[model samples]
Target chain A: MALDDPRATPPPDDPAAREADAARLIGDERLPCGRLVSHAWEQARAAGDQPDPHMDGCAFCRQAVEGLTALDSTTRTLWAERPSARTVADRVMRAVRAEVRLGRMLPLDDPTRELRIAETAAAKVLRRAADRVPGVRAASCRLTPAEGSTRVTIAMTLAVTLDRPLPGRAAEVRRAVAHAAEQELGLAVSTIDLRIASVLEPLKPTASDEPTLRDGSGR
Target chain B: MTAVRTASVERTAARAALAVPGVSELQPSLRQSLAEAATRVRRTLGSAAPSPETGIHAERAPRTGAWHVEVRCVLDEDRRALDTARDVRESVGSAVDAYATRHGIPGPVTVVVTVTRTTGHRPSHHPGTTAP
Candidate 1:
């Protein structure tokens, strides 16, 4: 039987006041719908809480609640799913702490925010400088901030022609690059570490090689 | 070929040295130490006055052959000034030796130890007098 049906049996009344109680129980205070849903909604709203309209009147809220309920039901239908309340609480607390730490490490409008930008610019400059140097073939540079100073370390492969004296010139180039970085960027150049990748060899002329032709005519 | 062999040897020697007793830490290279020294000196001079006898100063000298290490540390204990200096020298030397043996390099390790501050008692002032 539907709970709201007027024919539904009411709870047994006290025998001493059965006559008076029956009339009171049948009054407007006795809602047709089941008391469980109504009582829960009233209590939630009385505490200045938002009522889930699925349990009340609004269709949108009802639809949303019904969707969530359907999802839960589907999951349960597929498998027996149960999770401890403590585990959920712990996961939530850990997520909150991690977010707080992340927020502190990267606050908006921090002055140090420019440090990343400056480092990127400096890396580009170093790469350009290394490219200009005759012996350095391909170079990669890293700039790190350390204790009020910046350290730039470079790794590169040297050209075959410059391989013999690369080490000596490498130190000089590092110094020049570091000096340029400090003078131009106003950053304290702490150290410049250089690593040689590999030495390239020039192609040699061979008897089997054919001479190039201009306009399809052999020269 | 010889240069590659030498580099390998030096690396082996450096690793060996690190295993020695009283060795604290081994740096990948000496450039870090030099940079640290520069930082220490800048910080010391930019702040209040250091002690008279033991002010911030960096000394760099060649060790075995190619490697150089710089030490930048504070020294505040006034009574053990000599001990502190000796300890700094020994620690730096040991670290360099450790690195050289590990790398198998036979070069001297140059070490520069700087006493940034002397750890002694601060001068006491009169109870209620204000300096003019």
Candidate 2:
């Protein structure tokens, strides 16, 4: 066996550099997506194989595997709970509609007739527009309609894979949402209240339908 | 100015929105359903429950007397949802306008359409009939 070389340079420790390396690795198909990595973890665990070198050395893959393992453990603990009746999309839409219904309407200044835009509808427009941004999901929205203007309050959830600057992302989300609402609905948004509810880590592998080793081992 | 009842406006708008082809159904959001379910459970346990709203939401504009209509409907998967949404918008808008004109209401009505879901029970590219 060859002796381990002490002069070899280790992998980069900076978060950006590591992410750049990960992107390159993904492009090269050496380090696959997090879902594949999680699946590989499961397979390796079941096969009693050694941990792959990429995961052992790469921070990105290691975090993903850990997150998956933690999620699996958490899911197992809640296995007996009743499943949700509605899909996530349905739940989001419902919350938005209910919130809208409760909002006070703002008046319009049309010369032909008395006009108004419901605060709820304006909120929905903003939420949908904000959700279109990458890495951002609008969890909730509140619109306070004023004289010829509206103030938007948005509670957004974020999905982040690597260490990206969150302030920049938040600004981008705000601008995009504001622009979309103004252009699409023709409403003036005076203020935007953004609340970052939670940050979602990278996507993990879905639980496989295949029987686990635990189930088949005894049989 | 003729007195405009919100109920009448909602009814007219809902009728117009439903008239659009490929509209599957007006659906409440899942969150609302759960809240209703929880309220039902609470009522069974001796608590008050609030009624849930359906898909269409209509109200007067803020600061102005103009009416605003909001609708959320599911569409058939075969048809283009965007085009169907546009059709629904125009239909709702015209229906509101007609109601205002007939009733002699002084305020204008604006309709907002939101296509909430699409049913994929049947594929668009089947061999038999072309999707309308």
Best by lDDT: 2
| Per-model RMSD to reference | 27.4, 27.4
Task: Give a tens-digit lDDT track for model 1, residues A21-119.
Answer: 222333323234433332432333233355344456644333333433333333333222222455445545554553332211111111232222223
- lDDT per residue (tens digit) for residues A6-52 in model 2: 11212447553343232233332234444465344433343334446
For every candidate, the chain B TM-score is 0.40, 0.68
Query: Model 1 over residues B1-132: C-alpha lDDT tens digits?
Result: 154543443344334333334233332223333334334433333443422212122222335256554433333432232244345455546655665566565466554433322233423221222211
Error of 2 at B12 (Å): 7.1
Model 2 lDDT tens row, B74-128: 6674554545666777788888888877776646676666655455443212112
Alpha-carbon runs more than 4 Å astray in model 2: A1-102, A106-125, A148-162, A203-219, B1-132
